[model samples]
Target: MYRERASRVVGGAVVWESVSDGVAPVRVLPDGCVDLLWSSRRGLLVAGPDRTAHLSVSGPGERWVGLRLPPGAAPAVLGVPADELRDRRAPLADLWGPSAAAPAERAAAGRPAAVLESLARDRLRAAGGADPLGARLTARLATGVPVAAAAAEVGLGARALHRRCRHLFGYGPKTLARILRMRRALDLARAGVPLAEAAARAGYADQAHLTRDVRDLAGLPPATLLLG
Candidate 1:
């Protein structure tokens, strides 16, 4: 079973939990987000932004809880550049040290998801909150704005924009654009929109184009993911 909800402790973050029972590996699609996780088997961990889907398998009956930080919000709380942690999972102790990880893993309420959010909230405050640039960039691309136009609107030339985006989002804006476009298309399709119409609404060249992108980024076709 898996479920998620908006976080009370961290703005724009989602708290999710999943319990596995030896089913097939789960395909975790990329959505330009980072995660702070606690595994019943592994203790505290950090999941970095992904350029493509990640296949994850936990032991049977294992419980997993996580805080999914929206694009660009993780760096402030993690005290690490997003790019440095991209495409990988590391123990929280690796980033925050054993002592720091211990207290969070043993948070007061004994609820892993709540503890994760509280930890991120405290760390985010210490770091002065997430960069406002993240919201601006996400807003533009999510509406299907062209990357160059978005960059120009943000007052950054190509190189500067790329540099900042690499740090803030773990990838350049163009890649973020693609991820956002795929997400938009999938959401529409999941809502029962026709494939062709969803593609167009999401700025794809055609339904075929949307299929290719979904396969590439999510490791599945649109129909399969929608069914999933």
Candidate 2:
């Protein structure tokens, strides 16, 4: 149900196959590159190399405004209320909305700065007071530490961390950590390193752990994408 494609906009070439109609909890692998996701009724969700997720709904139609957020910007932007956007029938749509065109147009127009400013304004309005635990957790995630250890390091219990992460990032901390780790692994793989090496460098227990993380996040085995 979920589909994805890696493409080069300026070159106008389909660099990767598109993932279509994905089910909930889709795993997007680390590809050593970034992407701008657009769906007809699902709006837009921009994911970063650090496993940050940003969701936004398009006004209507195919016109979209692209916002190239800085790394670590998701926590700040995912401030919108879930119920206010769309029905939770489709988790993707509920996270984003049904307007994918605005971002496309913004990208074509080359006004990413302006688009980000607008998104920031909207986020500020939706976000409640900042959650310090979320900030601390993100910092630990960046280091590729295990979530359990990270939670303890931040003086938060596992359940408390999970609740706060869901409230802030729309997913659990473990999910975010996997995404982040996969992203890091992909970076190493793309750099021409061995998969096993990349996995270890990214903090996986071993190559198998790395493979599981990559498969869970990217929906493809690490070797398939990187080695093939």
Candidate 3:
């Protein structure tokens, strides 16, 4: 089973989950968010922004606590380009090395979510905060704004915008738009919107468009995602 809640200290969500039976495949759908995860058995790992469903298998009796970082925060907080860890689960030691990794390891022991927030704040204090432009771009894209217009609004040309997106979000603007659209559709459906209306509201050409995107991003059909 799994349970999650919002974090007051962090920009996104935090979750605690347990699995007691034999290892089972867990479909983690794309949401353009990065997760800092801790397991009693496996220690600290960063679950990177995914372009497709990430099927995770956990050991029996495994317990996990995770903090999901909002886009644009990962690079500043995790001290790595989003592109470097895209579609990957990486050991914190690999990026930060032993000295920095030691503190993160210690943080895993007590209040991992709060520790993650503190670490992010400290990193921002030293390295400066996430790009303000990136945050603005994310907001624009989340509302289905065209990439070209978003780029112009942010005063960046196409190539520069693409490069900045790779650094800040691990993918180009188009991919980020698709992920944001999918999340918006799911949120609408979960809130009891009809699938057809949700698709319309989320900027899809039609329900089929929504279905195709959901299948590609989530590995599930919209009907199954909403009703099952």
Instruction: Report the alpha-carbon TM-score of model 3 versus the true structure.
Output: 0.91
User: How close is every model to the real structure, measured as TM-score?
Assistant: 0.95, 0.56, 0.91
Q: Please report how far candidate 1 places residue 170 from its true position, in Å.
A: 0.5
Query: Residue 103 deviation, candidate 1, in Å?
Result: 2.9
Q: Write the per-residue lDDT of candidate 2 for residues 17-60, one digit (tens) a residue.
A: 23333323333333212223333344444544323322333332
Q: Against the correct fold, how does model 1 do in TM-score?
A: 0.95
Predictions in order: lDDT: 0.89, 0.52, 0.81
User: Which has the greatest TM-score?
Assistant: 1
Which 10-residue span in candidate 3 carries the lowest summed lDDT? Answer: 8-17
lDDT tens digits by residue: candidate 1, 70-188? 89888898999999889999988888786665655484237887678778888888998899898789889999999999999999999999998999899999999999999999989
RMSD of each: 1.5, 9.0, 2.0
TM-score-superior candidate, 1 or 2: 1
